[model samples]
Target: MVMEIVCPAGTPAALRAAVRAGAHTVYCGFNDETNARNFPGLNFDRSEMREGVDFAHAHGARVLVAINTFPRAGDQSIWHRAIDDAKLSGADAVILADAGLLDYAARTHPGLRLHLSVQAAAANADIINFYAGTFGVKRVVLPRVLSVPEIAAINAETDVETEVFVFGGLCVMAEGRCSLSSYATGLSPNMNGVCSPASHVKYHDNNGELDAKLGGFTIHRAAKDEPAPYPTLCKGCFSAGGQTGHLFEDPVSLNAEQLIPQLQKAGVRALKIEGRQRSKSYVAQVVRNFRAAVDALEAGRPLPEGMLARLSEGQAMTTGAYKKTWR
Candidate 1:
């Protein structure tokens, strides 16, 4: 079967653009602290989600609500209500990472489908199966740490459908558990659904060169004419282990468009595109490109030629751990 292409929609316009560009599903979050990628002027209000769902459904695409962040202590109600509202808004399913929130939804909204978000970092089969059995999760978004063979091994051990990221930003640390951003910016993705938030970034000139700093730490610098990548903590240059470089990962975005066949053969049920903060044009272009790739693959044709490299971060891309070089 052809794998499902799930794209991110930060706005109603992006949602419509993804649908029109041939996304099988578009996932998004509420404009609150309840979901990751909680950036300014992005995400959907309840009304926007409802309208976005209507538009997607009208075009034969599905909407998946992402209530993925862990709830604050003594404040689980907000996350719970986001799930309820997503269902009320006619979302096909809700992506969740917290065990308590998953349990609550399993009990309160028994009929609703649950997809374990990548934020959970349930990489191994033991933990993946545990989540599947514990919360009745229908799908699992594997963390970017697994190789294709490792993913195939996990599929051999579990019945849970798997999803993997195929494009956009890369995280060097496990998605949900990283504190590098919080240690520097004082906002936690676990509690606040934000990482290296734009509000705390500053751009300045240092000795005739441009530098982008995040939370007072110099992340990326460029010569006067070179493009400076965004100051995301994971993609930043830092000295560690006597290496003055992007110790975790270079400032390269994930562009695994070439790995579609291996992933399909490995039993991945869906392909996820990161970047809810992207423009509608970007979202549409990515969806269209991936759609064409998947279509050509389904037709048993060679995967399309290189098309998305120019759109990548720092104009460079990597297949992440899917190819085992990072492992």
Candidate 2:
């Protein structure tokens, strides 16, 4: 079977574009704090979400609402309302991470399908099966920390559907469990659905050097003519042992298009692209390429090579943890 192409839709236009471009599934979040990728001018408003869902359904595509952020104490109502609105909007599923919110969704909206978000970090078969057996999660977006052999092993052990990120930005730390952003900007990705928010980012021209700063800390210092990278905490440059460099992870994007066959062999049910903040054109291009590749794979044709290299961050791509050597 062709692997399902799950694309990101930050707006109604992107939603329509992905569906038209042949996406099997498109995932997005509410404009509020309920979803990750809660950047300024991104995500769907309530009305847009309803319309977007209708459009996707009409085009024979599935829409998954990402209400995956962890809810704050005494403010669980907001997350609950998100789940309620998603079901009303005719979402195919609600991707969730928090235990409390998952329980609420499973109990309150018994008919709604639930997916375990990568932020939940259900890396092993035991925990993945735990979420499935306990809350009835139908699918789990595995974290970007497992090798292909590991993923195949997990699939061999569980009956739940698995989704893996194949392209766009990469995360170094475990999803939904990183505290680096919170410590730097006081805005948690797990809470606010934002990491290294624009409110806390600043750029300075230091004479002949350009410095990118996040939360008053210099992340990268580039020459005047060089392009400055985004100051995300995990991908930032730092000094720990007299060596100043990307201490955690370099600013490289994941481009695993070449491994589509391997992932399919590993029993992956879907392939996900990771840029909800990207432009509609970029989303369309990515969706088309991935859709074509998977279609070719299903037909026993040669997979396209280097079709998305120009779209990779800094023109650098990695297989991430899909290969054990990356560990």
Candidate 3:
């Protein structure tokens, strides 16, 4: 079977671009805190979501609404409304992370398809099976912490479809559990949907050197002519016991294009691209390249080479935990 190409569409224009670029499925979120990538100008409104879903379906593509953030106490009405709106918007599925939200979705919208988000950190077979048996989740987006062998082991034990991130931002911590951003900005990524939010980010020019700070804490510094990475907490430069560098993780994006066949062998059903905050043209280019690669694999042809290296974060990429190199 051809691996499904799941692309991100942050806006209505990006939705059309991904579908036209040959994405089998495009995932997006509403312009609120219910989704993980809740940036200021990204994501769609209610009317735009309806139109985007209509457009994707008209082009023979599917749209999955991401209602993946954890709901705040005494304020679940917002999350519930998001689920209702997603169903009313003609979404093919709703990706969820919180157990309460999943339960609500399973009970309230019995006919709606549910996908387990990576934020749930359903890494093992038992949990994946639990989510499937309890919530009737049809698919689970595996967290980026698992190796190919680990994924294959989980696939051997569960019937739930597996989706893996094949490209874009790499998270060092387990999804849905990081507190660094919250510690710095008093906002949780899993709950508030903003990490190192632009509102708290500032840059300083110190004698021809630039310092990038997140929530007033300096995260990275470089010469004026050099590129400085965005000050995401995990990927930030920091001083440890004796050294100062990227103490947690380097600013490298995941690029598993070379592992398509291996991931397929591991029983992964879908390949997801991260970066909903990207431009429509970037989304189109990534969708096109990934779609072509999957098509080639289905036809038993050689996979394309060096097609997306230039698109990687900081112009560097890694296979992440797929190769188990960190161990």
Candidate 4:
């Protein structure tokens, strides 16, 4: 089978755009904290999710509702209700990370397909299989910390379908456990479904330099005429050992277009794009490019060269931990 192109859809518009752009699958979440990417003006309302799923199914695409964030203590009903709503809305699958939610879905809605979110960070075969066996997870979205060989090895040991993120922002920390965002902005990705929310971000002109701050901490500084990066804690510049630079990661995106064949050989069932908070036009363009690339790969043609490089706006793009050096 051809590798499925799974695109992110933050809204009804983006969902339609992804489907029309040839996405094999589109993933989105609810507007509330039940899902990640809980940004303002993003995500779908309950009714919108139903309509979006209808639209995707009509276009021959699959819709996955991402109720992936961990439910807070004594607040399980909200997450439970989200899953029930997803089922009622005809979602093809529910991507989840929390053990309680996973167990709930498996026990309460056993017919619904369960996909392990990258937030679970289930990197190796043992744990991936554990999820599959325990919660009946049908797929696992591998974390960003694995190399090609590592991914292949994991695939060799587990029968669960594997999905890997192929493009967009890269996170260096373990996905669900990272608290830097909360420490900086009082918001948590795992609990609250937000990271570096725009509400807490501010940019300042510092004479001949531009400084970007998140929750009052300077994350990036650039020359007046240079492009200033958004102040995401993971990709921030800082001083350590008397050296000032992006200590964790640089302001770069991931572009794995060239590694499609290798990933295919590694038994990956799906390729995921990571920008749910982007514009509809951007989502359409990216889905079209990735769909074409996968089509070419399946037809035994070389993947197109530099098809998505321009989308990064000349920012650095890396293969990240997929090449084996960073681990």
- In candidate 1, position 159 carries an lDDT of 98
The TM-score, computed over Cα atoms with residue i paired to residue i, of candidate 4 is: 0.97
Clashes of each: 0, 0, 0, 0
| TM-score to true structure, per model | 0.96, 0.96, 0.97, 0.97
Best by TM-score: 3
Q: Tell me the alpha-carbon RMSD of every candidate.
A: 1.5, 1.4, 1.2, 1.4
lDDT digits (tens) for residues 52-120 of candidate 2: 999999999999999999998999999999999999999999999999999999999999999999999
Error of 3 at 281 (Å): 1.6
lDDT of 1 by residue, 302-323 (tens): 9887688777787888888999
- Per-residue lDDT, model 3, residue 225, is 80
CA displacement after TM-score superposition, residue 188 of candidate 1 (Å): 2.0
The runs of at least 3 residues in candidate 3 whose Cα sits more than 4 Å from the true structure, single-residue gaps closed, are 205-208
Q: Which pairs of residues collide in candidate 3?
A: none
Model 1 misplaced stretches (Cα beyond 4 Å): 205-208, 239-243
Worst 10 residues of 4 by lDDT: 306-315
Q: What clash pairs does model 1 have?
A: none
Q: Which lDDT value does model 3 have at 95?
A: 97
